[model samples]
Structures are given as structure tokens and as C-alpha cells.
Target: LIITIFYSTDNPLNKSAITVPQRAVSTFDQQDLSINMHILKWKVTLEMIKDKPLFGSGIGTFKINYLDYQADFLQKNPGYIKYSGKAAEAHNEYLQMLAELGIPGFLVFLSIIFVFYSLALKYLKNKHNNQNRLIVFGLLMGITCFLIHCLFTFPFHVPVLGSTFFIFLGLSVVYIGGFGLSKVDTKKNIRIKLNLNYLIKKIIIILMFIVGIFLIYTLVFKPYFAEIHYFKGIKYYEKGNYNDALKDFKHAVWLAPYNGRILHALGSTYYHLDIQDEAQETLQRTKYYFNDRNIFRNLGLSYKQSGNYQEAEKEFKQAIYLDPNFTKAYIDLAYLYATQEDYDKAIIEWNKILEIEPNFSEKYNVLYFIGLTYQKKQMPDKALEYFLEALQLTPEGSPIIEEIEKEIYNIYKDRLNK
Candidate 1:
């Protein structure tokens, strides 16, 4: 399995043979493509670690925190083209733990692996009976394989597999005298005594309980509740309850102040509420955590809505600079130009959108807009051609179908009159 995994054309095995220019066009297989994404993920993790070195980004936050640190170059990379969704987990368990739980957590995880191997080896060497020895060897090999696989995949994320793995892990621990403690020897008259330093033990226990509670609340519970509130805000927003959405968004933001999504949502809710200044200020907070094109696009929209055309233009252009194929940015820019009566520039922007997005989902809408732009330019012939093309692209029952057909008929009528 290891040989097959690494020797494939897409994996890093061929990385050394490719020239600098060749690297650009080099195709990575699905597995290797994932590894390429992991490189980006690793960079994000490193940046996240810088901010929260002790506790890292907190539990269950790698996905939530990933986009903020995405490098602009990754947007242009072919390897990342189809890897559209958020990277929820680092494929590598060690790196995932390092990013989410911080250095101390990472070290503790390594210690667990160490203990597993140590006990496995001890059992393998000491077991005399052939059956028991073979069983021990198999368990050792199974664990070794599992750990090796965990290096490149998040097997533990799968519920059934993860449960089974832990079951085996528990069995291993039980077989090895439980929780790193040696088995008590009853035959030897050995008096095992606890070092009873009562006051000191009580203080230590209290301190541990306090620390555990704090860690659980800060890392686990708070983030979970924040996500819940963020989702609630989305639900409210979808129902057109802007005030409730605003309240939930604010609560989410308060809970997860460093969360980019929550902040972005809060800012968007503020914009929906027509509180432009607050929208801008709230969105600005996300800049500290996220360098995403979507966030920039939203920022541009906020500025555009506030009538700050220059800043809006700048933000939209920045979004394009970050992601050359960002169709939404192009559309927004085109509309912005159109609003300013720069029909020529608007048409040019609309054409650029076609150049980048041939298979755009809303192709008919885009064509219809191009037709409208041409009509505004007094080019009836060009307008008619695009309107006809849009008619073909439009779904049969779509409301826009009648509008497009009507425009086509009107253009032809005018031409006949001329």
C-alpha cells in the first residue's frame, strides 16, 4: 500500500525530476493533489500557531480558521482548482493536533504514540508462548500500520473506524497493565504505598480541576456555542429576520471574537441593517484573521453600498488580484462601472467575465447583461445577437426567457423601422 501510494505519478516521488517551469503544468493525482493542498494547510497552520502558540487555534477550529491564512498564490494554482470546499482537517493527524491543540497538546499526543510503541515492543519481546507472541506481533503491526496511515489520512475522523481503533487501543493498554502502570505482583509480599502528602495533593487536584474546566470551556464549549450562534444567525438571515440575525451574529462574534466567518457574517448583517459605518468597522476586524477574496468582495460591496465608489473599486480590484477567476468580483465591478455610466468599461468587464468563466452556471444572465450593455451603447445589431444567444442558454421555463425574447423582438422591430 505504501509503495503504491508514493510511487504514483501524482505523489511527490516525481517532484525532484520536474523543472521549475514544468512544475506549473505538472498534474498531481488525487492523492498528490491532496498533499499539495496539505502544503497550503501546513502554511496556514504555521501562521495560526504563531498567534496562539500555547493553545493554538482551539479544538474544531482548523476548518473555521483555514481560509483566513490561505495564500493568494494558491488561488491561481491548478492543483487547487477543483479543491473548492473548505479544508476541514489536515490529512496528517500530527499537524492537525499541532495546529488545533498547540505545542503542549502535540507533545502529549506524541507521548501517547511513544507509549503505545514501547508497550507493543515490550510485549512482543517478552511473550514466550507462540500463540500469544504472534497475537502481540499482529497487534503491534496493526498499530504501526494505523499510525503510518494516520500520517497521510485522518482515519480517526471516521466514526466506525475511529471507534474500532480506540477499542484496539484500549485492549492494548489493558494487556499492558493499564494506563502505563505495571501489574501488581501479589505473590511477592510487596507493600505498595501512596505518598500521602494530603494538603499538597488536595491543592494539586484543585488546580488540575480548575485547569481542565478552563480548557474545556475555552477550547471546546465556547467555540461550539459560537458555531451554533453563527448557524442560527444564518437561519435568521435566510428568514429575513435581520434584527434577530444581527443579534445572533453579534453574540457569535462576542463568543468567537477571532473567528473570521462570524465577524464577516456580523459585518454583512450590519450592512443589511444599513448601518454602513458599523459594517465597515466590523468587516475590518476580519482582516486581522482572514486574507480571503470572498471577505474582500464583501468589503467592496459594503463600500459600494455606502457610496464610497473609489474604495469599492479598489477593494473589488484587490479581490480580482487575489483571484483572477473570481466571477463575482468581475460582475460587481461591471455593475459598478454601469452605475457610473461607463457603459464601455462595463461591457469590457462583462466580456472579461466570459473570458474567464466560459462554463459559468448563470451564463444566460451574463449574456443577457452583455446584451443590455450593447443596447445601452446603441448597438442594436450586437444587442440582438447576444439576446438570441442568451435565449438559447436560458432555461425554457425561466422568467428571464420571456424578457430575453421580448428584447430580441423589440430590437428587430426597431431595425425594421430604421
Candidate 2:
């Protein structure tokens, strides 16, 4: 059971890996992605559980199959995709257990918890006559608190936190003498003895130790190492070192094959290097692990760069279909249209930004870009209208102020020349 769980949650995709829609009201200020959200987006998780209510989608398969379930849910309720974020773990641990292990497995899990508490109560009663009662009670309460926390978070999925849980459990087991106070434990200073009298017991202990080492190495160290490589790749990618980024991303993917975020990054880097075939192949592979608009947007960019305008248009539209309020996708789609010299369609797409009303900072860009688009179509009056509107919102002394004024001048100058 420990081995199975270790294999299951080895790595969780970063929450921001999913390109969720943001309200136009959110500040464009830089903020960390570690969202302190308590609400569990359990609809897709429930769907997965319903699909495999018996033994589950299989141990360690939730991350693998999560995207498919999300895709189906979004297809049926397209409007909900904007509200959805990528949940690498069902925030509710028990529901995740049910999703991964099914009803029977969930019940068995419940039974174990029930037994732990039942024994804890009994142990507490016996400990009342002992000096270590306070310590035992504290440990029990800590365990209880951790369990309640698990109902809303994935702390136990983290190695150090998870280890602390078992450490508490282990201390309790030692304090309770497995079930109750032992004869020796009745003494003031109770101590646990390691009695390996039987050959079988010795063999079992040895095997357990070996398994523990293997599990720690596989579950704890490997994922941590994978995260190191992934973040290093991100840093390199941001620094415009595509080769170094690709090298590290490949290392990350190799370390944790199931992590959708790592795969997505790798595909994106390929897209950046103008390796269209590799980019498409990698992003196509990424589709299997993550269901989000970002991958589609990236794919659209790859296709556009490769001169596949039709395919590029489809991918961008698909991204918009998945997340209507995703300003980046809307922008990308508008650019795609503009590239095809379909100014009307490009204007239509850019006009959708007005409907979205992205933040003040973003709105200015949208208006200015639309003005540019109109200018490209030789509609000076319409272009000037949008340009003036953009200028009104521009910051004092912003460099873009000059740019906008120049565009306005260009309109007047072009008309004079005519």
C-alpha cells in the first residue's frame, strides 16, 4: 500500500500549468503562482471516480487520466472551462483516494483510519494511568489536525509533511505498544524493544528496510531532483537559452514522465527553436497528459511559424473555445488573422477584447493594437478613434504616448498626402 501510494503522487503538475481565464479586474502585478485556494475543483475528479468506481483508474493513474476527464467535462459544459484550473491532485485527499482506489478501496482506507482512532482511544484510556498520557494526546490531536487539513489540502502528498505524519503515527504506535500499554510500558520510562527472535521476523524487517529505502529514493529524491531540472529549464528558457533549456527539460521529462507541466514546457521550447516537426510531435504528445488552452496556443504559434495558416487558425480558435476569456489566445488568434491580411476578421477578434475588457494595462494595448489593425486596412478615421481612446488611458510620459501620437500624426499626414 505504501509503495502504491508512493508511485501514485510522485509529482504533481504545477497549478498554473492550466491556462485558466482571469477576470479583467485582476491586477497585472507580478504574483507567485502558489494559490492558497481551499475550494476543491472536484467535478472532474468526481467524474473520474464515477467512471472507475470499483478499483479506480488504477494506482498512479489519476494524473495520467485527469486531462481526458477534464476534456470530456469541458466538452459537455464548455462555459465551465474558464472556471477550471489544473488540479494535479484532488485537493481533497479522500476523494482522490476514491478516484484512485474506488469505493472498496476507499472503505478499506476508512477502516484503517477507524482502527487507528479506535486503538488511539483505547491507548489513551490506558495511558491515563501513565505519565506519557499528555504526549500521546498531543500526538493524537496533531494527527487529527493533519487529517482535517487533508480534507482541504495535499500536505500529505509532500514528502516532509507526509513523513511527519508517519513519524507521529510511529510515535503513537510506540507509546501505545501497538494496541495498548504493555507490561514494560506501565513503568515510568517505557521503551520499545527491537526483538528479532524469529528468522522470518528478521527477514521481514530486512525486506521492509530495503523497501523503505527504495520508496524514499524513488518517491522523495527522484521527484525533488526532477523539480530541480524543471525549474532550471525554466530559468534557461526565460534567459533565451533554448539549447540549455531543452537539455534541462529533457532531463526533467526523463525524471518524471507523468508530469504534464514538464512535458508542456519541453514542447514549447521546441516550438521556440523553429523545430516545427519536433514542436508539433512534442505538443501532440503533451495533449495526452494535460488538457489546457496554453498547449493549443503554443501549437498555434508553431503552425503559424511553419506557414500552416489554416492549422494555426484552428489551434488558436480551439484555444479560445476552451478558454474564451484567455486574453493571450484571443490576441494570438487576432494576430493569426492579421497575418493572413484578413483585417476584418482580425478586427472582429481584437474587438472581442472590448467585450472582455482586460485590465487597464491590457486594455490600452488592445485598443492600440486594434488601431494599428484598422490603420493596416487604411481606415484612418476608425484607426484614429481607437488610437485616441488608447491614448486617453496611457500613463503620463509613457514611451507609448509618443508612439500613439505618431500614429495619429501619420493618419493626418497620409490624408494630406492624398
Candidate 3:
């Protein structure tokens, strides 16, 4: 039975590589596209609007306008045509909405962000209670991270993310707005009812009761349901039954929509299922519940798999922007540029990684790629330098190390013999 269980579990791992062939293909094919393409799209969209900041383009017109603008842009910058195929969306939902939905959508979006931040800040600032302050801080950071990430990717544009965010916003508004005000009113009532010492004692007793109830609810009641659904989702996810996993995850989310971890798991499962759109949407929903960089990285990768390179790069950059020490984004961005044969950009990204992480010894692969790029650029000396650097970084006895050493020797010998 143990053997059977192990085999059954391993089946998903074995078949995972083949489950989404099209997505894999798209990831490989579009991995190396330039980030400039996304920037160009943004620039063209802005230019077409004649610098108007208030009124946006119109609903559903961002994609159309992006394409129209790209055509004009390509005429001026012919190099873009070789890399880009379709006239994609503005890669930025805010900018896209600003262009398409005009001023109304922008204001609505900004207003929502403002409300979330305001309530979170209010709770954090005035709340003397430690527990309430922690919750408020979590919500504040979550919303802030989401908004900052949105500057790059359009996850909020998706219904799942928008709905989830609004739900959290509503919950926050209620929790902070109601509870804080109620506490003040309760204090006033207590003062009116008794002497100062008695009122203080009464408040302490009430707070203690509430804390006890919360502890009981969290420790005894909440775990039973949350654990059951969480495990059920994990089982489905492990078995490669993504539909079942998604249902279970959705149930978990429904039970506790404020749980960021659950939302991230659901979003990741959706991504593995090749439901890129759904994955993007679900992951976006997680912003209200938690602040996890993994979600941003996965969301970016999902967009990349969906042939949305512009959006993918944006998310990757957002991840980096959020935590400059996030090494994965640097590697992914490097891989992205390398795949597109934009070796210069790849080298730039890799160099940035080295700058941020000087001791990142695993960057031999990046060094090798830098060598390859120099070779492509027909700069033999530069290529040789990087090849030597790669050789130095490689493990002493590894086959890859030996191979790199051999290549460096050959390159040097050939150059000297010339």
C-alpha cells in the first residue's frame, strides 16, 4: 500500500511536464522578448492620447488603440517588428483603463485604492490594541503591495482580483470603521455609567472576554473547517486533478476569503491547470489577503505562458521593485531576454543580479549565456572573458565545469594561434 501510494503520488510529478504542452511551448518561444516592447506600447498609447491625463481612451479600446499605436510606432522604430507579432494590450491596466475607460475608471480605481489605504492607516495609527493593530498592518501592507504591483500588471483588471479586493476592502472598512467607532461610543457610555476606576475595570473585563472568545474560535472552531478544506485541496492538487483542486481551493477561499495563503495556493493551482486567465485573476485576488512575492512571480510566469510577454515582464519587474533582493525575478528576466536572443538585455539583467547579489555563485549559467551573447555579437575577446568567468564559477569536479574549462581553453588557444 505504501508503494502504491508513492507511485500514485509520483504519477502527477511524472505527467506534470506533459500536461500543458502548449503553455510550455509558448513559454519557451516568447521567453526572450525585449521589455522595451511593453514600454513602447505604453509610450505609444500615451502619445496617441496627446498627454491627456483626465479623460481615458474608452472601455475595451486599449487593445485596439495599442495595436493602432504600435503600427505607427513600428513605422518609426522598425526594429520592434522583428520581435513583436500582435499589437498587444498596454500591458498596464491603469494606463490601459486610463486610455480606454477614460477618467471615470481611473478615478474609480484610485478611489478604491484610497479607501483601502485610508481605513488601514486609520486602524494602524489610532488602535491601541495590539491584535487589532496587527490585522490592520497586514491589510495595509497587502493593499499597498497589490497597488504597487498593479502599476505593472493588470491583475486587478481581471474579475477575480477586483472582486476579491473589493471584498477585502469592504471587510476592512467594516472592521476598522465600525469597530473603532464602536469602541469610542462604548467608552463614552462606560464613563457615563460609572466612576473612572469602575469604567476602566469594565473595559478590561470586556476586552478579556472578547480575546478569550477569539482564541477559542481560532484554536477550536476555525481549524476544523479550514484544515479540512485546505487538505482536500492539497490532495486534489497532488493528484493532478486540477479541476477538483480548484473547486476545493474555491471552497477554502469561500470559507476564508481573507486568507492570502489559500488564495495563493488556488491561484497557483489554476496556473498549473493552464487556465492562465483564471490564474491571473485568482492570484490578483490574493493581494487583499496576503503579501507574498511568490504570487507576483507566478502571475508573471502565467502571463508569459499566455503569450503576454509585456505583462509578464511587468509583473517580474514589479516583484523586483517590491523586494530588490528577489533573485528569482532577476534570473527569470535574464532567461526572458536570453530566449528572445536579446543577449545585450540578458547580459544587463544578469549584471544587475550580480550587482545585487555579489556572492550569487550559481550565476555560472548566466556567465555562460553572456559568453554566448558575445559570441553572437562577434566579440571573441569579450566572449572568452565571460567563458573563463563561467569556468571559474563552475563546481570543481562537475561535468559542466569540465566542459566550460575545455571551451575556454579551446577559445584561448585558437585566439593565440591566430
Candidate 4:
């Protein structure tokens, strides 16, 4: 079916108008097959975990058991395992709950879905009102889609997806419950009248207002606390207290896992402590969490410091890929090449830097390195040219000027003696 879809020919739907071509039809068929396979895997997964429908194995344990489960399944049913190499998940909502949380969790999960569906059905039957029905229908469809998608993807295990799913679930429950209650209340003699005691009414209103404000503050302004911790981490970083910096940054990232800067800071702190592996892992995680070019640069630096030159080069390139005009990446790449004695590659990187920022303040450093490279390559005259350029850029009595002058003197003296 997949092959037929991908290789199918297009035919005109009408004599006057264009239709989906055979190529498109084929592609669609292939895609349809892939989706079907995904759905089938999810179904099999659900059936496998049907017996363990309550209180799942435990939170975050599915992946560990997934391989073993797949191996056992493959051993018993070779036909099913032939299509896909391995099954990593049960792929069904109830199965995921059983594998991770255990039977109880699965039951609760199913109960939540059952209640939602029931409420949705009840709302549709009574609320013949179009607007309310539309709202309920939309909510029901959204929740249904969430469950269906969860079968193929571990959406419930992913932090963002899980949180979003639960939030939507809560919204669905509130709408369904509120709508049902409002309808029931309308038929009852429940008179919601204002109290004659003004003080009591004022107190109730104040309490409600306070509660509303607290909710807003907690959800909206609570992030500032994480930001405070981040800044404290920065202070610790500046003081070279890596352990404390790491702790604070970890807290900040824990509080705001999406913060790229915090992750980068944590990675850097780990790098300085000479924990190269940790630094690399943290920085990689940072990249996954955020797409900031600075993190790539920091990652490159960490790799360079750890003597992983190839990986460092890759990360520097990635940084440049993310931000072409990121001057620091160019400089770092040049320095990295220079450290490897690949003067030609180093020059190429430096030239790139010059192209991006013609009057880049670091030109002297590049010139000085170029001179050193030429000297290493046994081109004294060419090396002298770059040294002169570098010296011209340096201030009088600058250490760079002093160093270049000494080199020039030595070169000249050696040439004359020879």
C-alpha cells in the first residue's frame, strides 16, 4: 500500500480543472500506510497491558521496561515483530498508565476519560442550544484527539504535552460540570440572593478577590522568583564558586526549564568545574530545551576546553549556522584551528570574521596569529608583513606590541647572521 501510494499516477478529477496528480496520490497512500502502522502498534500495546490496568509500574519506568517487553513479545510473536524492529511503548493510553503508573493510575486515567465522555454526551442530549453544544463538541473532539495522539506518542510523559493535556482536561471538566450544574440549578428553587448583612457580603467578596489575585500572582509573577535565583547563580559564577553556581542555576532551570540562559549558565558552570561530560550533556540538554546560539557557542567552548577539537569545531559551526554573524563563533573556530596547527583553516575562519565585521576590534589578534602561523610555515617575509600589521594596531607599550617587536628583532638578527 505504501509503495502504491508513493508511486501512483495523478489523474484529473474534472476535464477543465486540475486534480491531485498520481505522484501525490501515491505519496498520500504511503503516508496513510505509515499512519496505519502507528495506530496498529498502539492497539497492540493497549491489548498487552489490559491485565495491568491499574496503578502503573511507576512514574518514568516505561522506557526501561519497553525493550524487555518488546523482546518477549518478539520471541512469542515473530510475525508482529517483523514489521517494526522493536516496540518501545505500549502505545495505548491505558497501557502507558499500567506500564508507568500501574493499575491504579490506568484506572484513574480511564475514569477521567469516561467521565469526560459521559459529561459530553449528557451536555449534547440536553443543551440543544447551538452555542453550548458547539463548545462541548469542540472540547470533546479536542480531548478525544488528545487520547488518540497519546497512543502513538508519549504525550502524557512529556512535560509540556502532559501539562497542556491536563490543563485542557481541567477546562473540559469545568465546562461540562458547570454547564450541567447550571442547567440543574435553573430547574431548582435555589435563590442566590445577596445577604442582608453587608459586612458578611463584603468579607466574602474580599475573600474571593484575594483568592483571584493570589491565583494570578502565582501563575504570572511566580517566575520572578526563578529569575532571582538565576541572577544569584550569575553572581556565584562571577565569584568562581562553580558548585554554588551550579546549584542555583539547576534550581532556576528546575523552576524555569525552558530558560535557555539558565541552562547555558549551568552548562558553563559544569565546564569550569572540569566536568566535561556533564558540561556536554547539560549543554546538549540546553540546546534541546532552547534554540539560543549562545548555548552553541558555550557548548563549543566547553568541547574545546575538554580537548574534543572535532566536536568543538562542529559546535562552533553550529553556532555560526544558527547565527552567521556571530563574531565569537568565527573567532573561536579560528582559535580552535590555530590550536590544531591547521593555519590555513584558521586563516579561513579569521577571514570570515573580517568579512562579517570589517573593523572588528579583534583584527590585531587575528593578524598576530597569522604572523605566528606564517613563521611556523617557514615564510619569514610573509610572517613579518602580518607582524607589522599587528604592531601597527597595538598601542605603544602594549604587551602584544612588545612581543611582536621581539619576534621581529629575532627574525631580522637571524636572517642577517645567516
Candidate 5:
């Protein structure tokens, strides 16, 4: 301590060192100063555990279902919204296993690990096993390396890495048991009896094999074909080629009529094409088949376009309930409120976007919209505050900067006249 103090500065920190400016980096961007996203993901995983503590959401369903749980958490803890996204991994393998497999599976997994280490420790410490100790130690180290990697990453998800780890563990077990990892009594295992029942068993096995092949073709290969069209439709959709996207999606739907994902994309295309009736019709079909938040969001958009504000509001709320961390849904819902001339409600909704701005990408948009809403409510001072905030976030040489400056100038001019 004396040595450290001798080398370090004796000066105290000032306000400039203590406080960061909001102008350059908004509070939204600053929310994720470190690994907060991972922290948020683990919190969501805990919630998933509570919802289904026994069987879990299911093996490998973490990627498919974690978003809904995160959205629910964010709805109550709005401040954590900035740290939300579709994270594919929980960033902690132990937590992920507990979440996706439930308590029973988690305990079983832990037991396997515990037993392995217990046997390993016993084998390593045995003085009689000294000759093979070096090999066992090497293999154990390889497995341990992967185990350490699993603390911050899902190494098991990577086939090569996971296989390597298991190979190391198997080798360690083999080396630890110099006599062999397993033994079978040849005298007890070699007896075989042939009878009429043997022929019957062969025939049944052949039939079962054929049935399994048929099922694989129907469930796996059939969907494989639909996935081709589905991916083609996605590419077209991204290029803003709605007509091409619609054609491909229609073919995909024809191939896999019950595929909710494909159906949802089709519905969204119809909405973008201004066919509100077909959009609503198709989206409603998706509702029965899929539980995606995007489906509900598109349904709300279609309803709003059709002048059904009540239904639109309900659909948007449903979407938010499904995934509050989806920033677009809140923005759309706020715009819906703004269209109804409900300035206060619109501002409130827009402000929520500020609370959960992903990378502060929507900071300028939220501030500018709230400013306009305040202006509409005859609150010029509040409007100016938001406009100036938006201006501070604006990048140099952007056309929007001038627009914000114009709004600010107008507010000042009107105030001077008053």
C-alpha cells in the first residue's frame, strides 16, 4: 500500500472526471458501458427458469423463446431496455442449461460433471496410477480448458469444440483406468439363441426402418424445400422487392401451409403492399400458428391503416406485451397515438423509446418526435428542450441538423414576440 501510494497521484478528482456529458453520448448509449447486455440476458434467463422450473422451455428453445421473456422483464424494468437484444446465447453455459433444461435437467447435468471430477480427482491422486498420471493430466487439462471457456461462452454449441472437449474427457477416463474404462464378461455375453422369433424380429426391424425413413422425409426433407423458398422470399423482402417477396412467400406457404414464420412474412408483405384486408387476413392466420411479436406488430399496422384505431391499439399492446424491448413496436404505437392528436400520450410513448434506445440509434428520432408533439400541445419551452437535445445528438453535415436548428430558431423567435 505504501509503495502504491508513493507512485500514484495525490490530486483529487474534479466534476469533469466524475460526470460524463450527455451531449456526445446519451444516457441510452452509456447504459451499456460494459457487459450489461450479458447481465440483462442472465436476468431474463432467470425469469425463464421461474416460468418453467421443472421441464424448462425445452432443449435448444432458448434462442427461439428468450426474446419474449426479455421483453416482459424490460416492460417492468424500463431502464434495462437499452441493454436488450436477440442474444443467441446466455453468455453463461451453466445458466443457459438451467434455463433451457429446467431444474431436473440442470441437476442431472451437474451430477454428471460432479461425478466425472470426483472420479478424476480420485484417479489423479492414486499413487499406483503414477505411470499414466501424465497422460491423464494432459487430457484433463484439455477438458478443463473447454470448461473454463464455457464460463463466458457456449463452447458446447460449437461442434468441433464440444467434440474435442468430450474426446479429452474420454481419453482422461481411459488413461485414468489403465486396465480399461469398461469391462465385459465374454463368457456371459457370447451366448446366442436362434428361433422362429428371430425371423419375426428381422421383419419388424425392416418395417420400422422404412417407416422411420418416411417420417424423416415428411418432416425434415419436406420442410427443407420450404426453407429454400422462405430464404428466397427473405432476400427479396430485404431488397424492397415486395412483389418478388410475395411470390416466393406464396410458394413457401403453398409448400408449408402451417409454417407460421413464412405466413408472418407473407402477411407483412401484404401490409406493405397496402392490401390491408389480405394483410389482416394472413396475419390472423399466422396468429393461430405462430407466437412471434413481429406478427402482432404487423397486424397492428394493417389495422391502423384501415382506420381501426381501437383494434390497432390492442394489437400494438399485444405486440409490446410479447416483446417490449422491440423498439419499433413502441415507435409505431406512439405514431398511432400522434395520428389521433393525443399529444401527451404520444410523447409518453415516444419517451419510452428513449428509455430503451438500442445503441442510441433512435435517440434523434425519439427526441425530434417528442419535440414536435410538445409543439402541438402549445408547450414551446418543452419542445425547445427536446429539439436542442436532438440537435446535440445530430451528426455534422446532416440535413436533419438544419431542420432541428430551424425548429429551435422558430421557438426562440415566437418567445421573443410574446
Candidate 6:
């Protein structure tokens, strides 16, 4: 199925597309960034490990604490922001266990697998019955496959699959014990009557099971459902369906009220819907939970949209202070300055962006904007210099090349007329 999909007529992996180096590079970069996200997630898991090295961050705490770790990672690697939206599970299960459950829990998990293998081997050695031996071998192989899968994927994290595994494990242990109906000694298997003590113990067991189920439902099921809705909201937001996205995000926030990322998403959707006041409030709430530069950038955007230039500038500055490599904040600050006709300050901020991100993806755009800023300041010479540089940097056949050429031509025309 994967092969067929990749080779399908409409797929990017079609032979014709793969032959184009530029297209291949772009495609490869996309995949590369996705793989890098796992590594980035691993780094965050390590942070979780550091935070709770004794027992771990706690079961299911990965999703809860992930945003805080991701925020720290993004500050140092701002380029990662492109792939970061929702928090992620630690793709590596062993690392995840170590981070969440700590060393003792991790060792206990390992011991279970080790015991399973040991029992499988013991059963396999008793080849008096080849059928039972083959069954044991198959069981061993299944366990091996499961363990290997768990290394790369969170198979043990899925409630249904994980429960199935434990069930199989119990069956494997029983088979290894060679338990049989024929060997049941009914006289020795005495059944206890339901006395008061027995009834009390049964009730306690039932209560414990109920409490366990409730905890799992609240901690795991609720958050999982919330994340599903959050992703749906992101899809809606991408499709420009702000109202539906807002509804979905709000539902997610309601389900997982402690989820900082969902709150951030809700706040961003509010900004997109032009509810600047609500956006600011929600984003501020997000900031109270996580100190992420993107949160500040979005807050600044909310302030800017509401025409509160001073507050917007302060937020943008705070964002830059948090992450020096946050080029978007610098661009926002420069744009804000230019909006207020603070041309000289705008020029300085634009230059600072270059200093911080010399090879920024939008370097040409920055240069062109700096040129415009210079032109606004009546420094035609500096304006032409920057404009020409921008023109050279623009892709040969890009529409932006024509725009830069026009800007250069206008500068020359104005000088000639003067």
C-alpha cells in the first residue's frame, strides 16, 4: 500500500518529480524537517528526564509538560517553529519511559520483557511436544516484534493495543507454566464461599478497578480527545474557517484546561477571527502558563491589530529578548516602526534582524523593506544601494525581481527628474 501510494500518478514521488533536483531538494527538506522534529521531541524528553530523573515526569505527563519543554527548545532553535504547532509524544518509547516513569519504572518494564523471553525459552526447550514448542517459538517471536515496535513507536501507550499485549503476556505465562484442563485437580482447587471478609475484599478490588478506570478516562481519554479536536481546529484554521476552528479549539481547551498549547492555538485562532481583545486575553493567559517567544509574538500581533502600537512594540521586544534568533519578532518590530514613520529606528531594527539571522529565508524581503525605509527617510543613495542588492538576491524568474526592478527604476527616475 505504501509503495502504491508513493508511485501513484498524482503523488510527488512520481518518477518525473524525483528527477528534478530542485523539487527533490524541497521534498527532501520537508521530510528532513519532519525527522528533525522527532529529534527535537527527544531533546524535550531529555529535559523531562532532567526535571524528574527519579520516577519520571509521571505517566501521561509527556503531553502535559511537552509544551514547556518545546518552548525552551524553540527559543534556542527558532527555525524549529515551522514544524512546531501541537506538542508531540516522545517517538522513542524507551526514552519516553525514562522521562515519564524514571529509572526504576524503566527497569521494571525491561524486567517484564526479559522474564517473558526467559519463559519462552524455557518452554521452547521442552520439545517433548513439537506443537507446544512451535507455539512458544511463535509467542517469543511475537513478543520480540512487539518490543522492537515499542522502541520506535508508542505501542504501549495505546490503551487497546497495550491491553491486548498484556492479555497475550498472561496467556504466554500460563502456557509456559504448562497449565491444562486435564491436570486441574478439582479436589485441591477449593473455591471459597462469599463470606463477609471475602465480600469486603471483592468490593475493595471492584472499587480499585473503578478508580483506575476513572483516572485513565480523565487523564488519558480526555486529553487524547482534546488533542484530536485541537488538530481538527488546526485544519479548519488552515482552511480559513475561523469560526469552526475557534469552536473546535474552545472545545479542546474545555476538555484539557491545563493544556498550554491548546490555549495558544485558541488565542491564535481568536486573533485570526479579528477578536483582538479576546486574542490578547487568551494569549496573555497562555504566556502565564508557558514562556514561549511565539506566544509573545502572537500577543504582539494581537496588540498591533488592536492599534496599540506601544504595547505591541513592548511584546515584540520581549519576544526578541527571549529568543534573539526570532526573526519574526524583529520583522514585526521593524514593520511596527515603519508603520509609525519611525524610519531611522525601523532601519536599525531591520539591520539587527540581518545581524541576528544573516541567512534568513526572507532575507531579500528584509533588504527590500529596508530600502523602502531608507527611501521614506529621503536617503535615495542608501535606498538604491539596498534595492539593487535585493534585486540581485531575488530569484531570476521571480515576480519579486520585477517589483525590485520597478523600485530601482522609480528611484532613478525621481533623481533624474530632480
Report the lDDT tens digits of candidate 4 across residue range 1-418. Answer: 5544433434343342423464345444634655555554554455446534555556655543444444444455554432442344555555666667666666776887787788788878984679878988987888788887775566776679889988988887788777664545656768888756989889989999999998877666666877999999999999999899989998887777776668889888988998889899989987654556677788899899989999999988876654556788998998999899998898788778777777878788778878888887788998899899888988666778888998799789989999
TM-score of each: 0.68, 0.70, 0.44, 0.49, 0.70, 0.65
Worst 10 residues of 5 by lDDT: 15-24
Candidate 1, superposed: residue stretches over 4 Å from native: 1-71, 74-85, 94-119, 131-135, 156-221, 290-293, 317-326, 355-357, 409-418
lDDT tens string, model 2, 156-215? 678899899888887787767744455554557767776657887889989999999999
lDDT of 3 at 127: 41
lDDT of 6 by residue, 195-264 (tens): 6777888998999999999999999999999999999999999999999999999999999987888999
lDDT of 5: 0.82
How many backbone overlaps does candidate 3 show?
A: 5
The CA lDDT at 293 in model 1 is: 75
| Pairs of residues at least 3 apart in sequence or in different chains that clash in candidate 1 | none
Clashes of each: 0, 0, 5, 20, 0, 2
Best of the two (4, 6) by lDDT: 6
lDDT of candidate 5 at residue 41, scale 0 to 100 = 86
The clash tally of candidate 6 reads 2
lDDT of 2: 0.80
lDDT tens per residue, model 1, 170-271: 787676663224766668867777697899889989999999999999999999999999999999999889999999999988888999888988988888
Pairs of colliding residues, candidate 6: 55-101, 55-102
**Which lDDT tens digits does candidate 5 get at residues 76-163?**
8987865667776898888899888999998997887787787777767766555576766666666777788787678888889878
Candidate 1 overall lDDT versus native: 0.80
- Report lDDT per candidate: 0.80, 0.80, 0.73, 0.74, 0.82, 0.82
Runs with alpha carbons beyond 4 Å of true place in candidate 2: 1-37, 58-84, 123-136, 177-229, 251-259, 290-292, 321-324, 375-380, 396-403, 410-418
